[model samples]
Target: MTEPAGETPIFERIGGAATVDRLVDRFYDRMDSLPEASGIRAMHAPDLGPVREVLKRYLGEWLGGPPLYSAERGHPRLRQRHLHIPIGAAERDAWLLCMQGALEETVADPQLRAGIYDAMARLADWMRNIPEDGRDQAAP
Candidate 1:
């Protein structure tokens, strides 16, 4: 069937809720094991189950799938929500690393993957609350 008018939403292009869930699963799994992500990982609870579900909803809606996150959590004041987390340059980069890896594994379109990565990288940086030290370095 011909796609409806306007841009094909990223949500549909990425295969909707099920695909978003898989991406979140991969993201968290990488977070669980990546050394570069250890600092960020420590910020989570011993079990990642709760967070994973929450993120699935958030990402599902964020990528144009459905309004799952807002229906549950209200506006995504991401920076305010993460204010308690000690996000700095390192934490931001670590999060991005997992997200990039997840996107690569899940999204076949290279351009779409790169676009999502870029958006995520920007969002990750915005979550940082700590003042940038001169040494704030990019994620390896």
Candidate 2:
């Protein structure tokens, strides 16, 4: 919420739209390759085209950049949108793995990257809908 002097926003500090795009690209790339991410990946379509752009726009606004996502899609309602997906601890951790890996490669600032990781981990956890009680997960 409060950025230090000359720090600008997280969005701007990370090079704005271009950086977000690259991060998203790397995130999906990791998901495509990471075995642990297979469950989360199965939640998506065979192609990542539509979700890719949506994530870019969503991250753009989420990091305090332009309101591209809100303008186009109204409120993000992240948890509501993701409730349909079975995002228990494992799924959340897998998602974070891809994102944290992507951030490591894309963001040069270690502190900033850590901050993003911390925030995103919490958000991802909050997206959990199904209980993680060894119950059978719903089909994606």
Candidate 3:
């Protein structure tokens, strides 16, 4: 079905959960390799397996596919979950950069890409937990 303005659902426009999964995979892969992401990357466990799965499930529900993440993990409480992480400006930007790169590589539709990117930017900014003075250094 079409939206009121004749726009397609974001899920269908971006090929649904499969596409979101691919985008998350590519995003983590980029993060795993990029030196700029080392700080945030180090916050994760040594293995990326869980991270990959969690993001896939989260995005699946987030992108209007299925409620995989919320069904299992309950409310995202994204800010609460990220409170332990030292999410300064650099980390936030780095995360957004990796995600942007992945979105660019995985999505072919311009409208879908723009919508996803905008939402992601807002979420990433909201996830920031570090104080402006940057004193917090504890791990996530």
Candidate 4:
């Protein structure tokens, strides 16, 4: 399907479904193997397969390829969906670290990589539910 006003979607620019698949695979691989990511990685199920598929679909739709994610799972209330997990500065940083590596490994275009990383950094920061000082916001 054509994107509105003839602008090519980021998904197409970034090489479509194949690239998206590779990106997600690398992202999870880093999370699974990086010592610095252990804390955040522990938040995931022992088997990464399911989450990997979810991310691929979510990212594909987010990058404007197809609405596969929302079509199957409805709205992606990401923050709400992650509320059960406690995220702070460290968690956000770790997540970004994995994402940065994945982007560098998958996206050859520097400008496109920077844009995607910046947006992802914002999303990661927004997912933080705990303060940098380690205080839980949900606590009194």
Q: Model 1: runs farther than 4 Å from truth?
A: 1-5, 133-140
- On TM-score, the leading prediction is 4
lDDT for 103 (candidate 3): 94
The per-model lDDT (C-alpha) reads: 0.84, 0.87, 0.82, 0.91
TM-score of 3: 0.86
**Runs with alpha carbons beyond 4 Å of true place in candidate 3:** 1-8, 133-140
Candidate 3: the clashing residue pairs are none
Ranking by lDDT: 4, 2, 1, 3
Candidate number of the best lDDT: 4
Q: For model 1, what is the alpha-carbon lDDT of residue 38?
A: 88
Q: Which residues of candidate 2, in runs, are more than 4 Å off?
A: 1-7, 133-140
Per residue, candidate 1 scores C-alpha lDDT tens digits across 1-140 of 12246978788897888788889999999999999998989999999999999999988887877788899999988787887788887888889989989999998889878887888888787677775764333322
- Pairs with backbone N, CA or C atoms under 3 Å apart (clashes), candidate 4: none
Better of 3 and 4 by lDDT: 4
lDDT of 3 by residue, 1-140 (tens): 12346565666678888898899999999999999888879889999989899999888777766778999999998788878676878889999989999999999988778878888888887777775665543333
Question: What TM-score goes with each of the models?
Answer: 0.89, 0.89, 0.86, 0.91
Candidate 2, 6-61: lDDT as tens digits: 77899998888999999999999999999999998998999999999999999988
Model 1 residue 106 lDDT score? 94
